[model samples]
Target: MFIEERTADDLALIRLLDAAFAELVARYGLEGRSGVGPGAHYLVAVVDDETVGCVAVQTTDVAGTGEVKRMYVAPAARGQGIARALLKEIESRATDLGYDRLRLVTGHLQPAAIALYESAGYRRTEPYGTYADRPGTFCYAKSLAG
Candidate 1:
């Protein structure tokens, strides 16, 4: 698999994000939502001319940190290290974008995501975004500073 920077505006990326977001909402019984807004940098995992996985990072309103969003890999493509590779790419891009840290929010319903973040060196953080002060929200942060 190859990981490369892509635009969130790409149709393929949007389709992937939409599917992932729908699954997330259904699985967690939350409201529907789309991916991040413009100015977010996207990374896609491509295999055989198909986009199988994707992740994105956008500069948060907060200083010195970027927020990670829309991370997903096709079920058919799991266990192939695509998520890890995409995350590492995001970290490198964030550092290059002058961000000192990265933050993300995931629901406890997704234990796999929680475990991935924990094992990837992200620690619990106070709720951010719409998750603020909400129960069942799991926030995580990791330093990207050298």
Candidate 2:
């Protein structure tokens, strides 16, 4: 599979993302929500010309930092390292955008996601955003070379 930047309007990407987010909410009791905003930056993974995974990142209000808003790999596409590639791609883009750090919040129930982020050089961080103080949220951050 190959990864590339894509619009949130892509029908396949949207459906995959929706299902992924719904799963997160159900599994982790998460409350974070998503929207099409100015800060949005999205990427999708394609295999055989079909979108199978996706990720979204946005510059947060905090200077020098960016947030990974969403990441999803279709069930059929899991275990293929798509998530790792997407995370690395986001960090590359964030670094190019002059961001010095990247932050993301996943849910406690998603061990695969947490492991993906941690294995990608991200470190656990204090809670932030809508999930702060929520028992099921796990936050992470990675410093980029500005």
Candidate 3:
């Protein structure tokens, strides 16, 4: 699989975002989708020229920090390491953009996602921003600094 940076408005990215949102709604009901805003950079994983996964990073209120957003790998693309590739690419992009740390929030219902984050070196961290008081939210952060 190959990963490349894409604009937030890219059609392929939009489709992946829609799918991710649908999955989130299915798993957690009608909760708000937060942390996606202006100045975000997105990346997509392509397999056989098909966009099969996507992830994004946006500047956070904290200096030198970015928040991971809309990370998703199509169901058919799961188990192929697309999510992990998208994540590693996004984290690299975040660091290149001057972010010293990356943070993300995933619902407790997503055990596979939780495992992915933990296995990727992300440590459980206190919920921040809008997610702080939202129960069932699992927050994680990984330092990009060596």
Best by lDDT: 3
Clashes of 2: 0
Candidate 1 stretches greater than 4 Å from native = 32-34
Q: lDDT for every model?
A: 0.87, 0.81, 0.90
Tens digit of lDDT per residue, candidate 1, span 84-115? 89999999999999999999988878888888
Predicted candidate 2 versus true structure: per-residue lDDT over 28-72, tens digit per residue? 444545453575888888999888888888878799998887788
Q: Candidate 2: which stretches are off by over 4 Å?
A: 29-36
User: Which window of ten consecutive residues has the lowest lDDT sum in model 3?
Assistant: 27-36
Q: Which regions in candidate 3 have their CA more than 4 angstroms from the true location? A: none
Which has the higher lDDT value, candidate number 2 or candidate number 3? 3
Better of 2 and 3 by TM-score: 3
lDDT for 60 in candidate 2 is: 86
Candidate 1 lDDT trough over 10 residues, lowest sum: 28-37
Clashing pairs in 3: none
When 1 and 2 are scored with lDDT, the better candidate is 1
Best by TM-score: 3
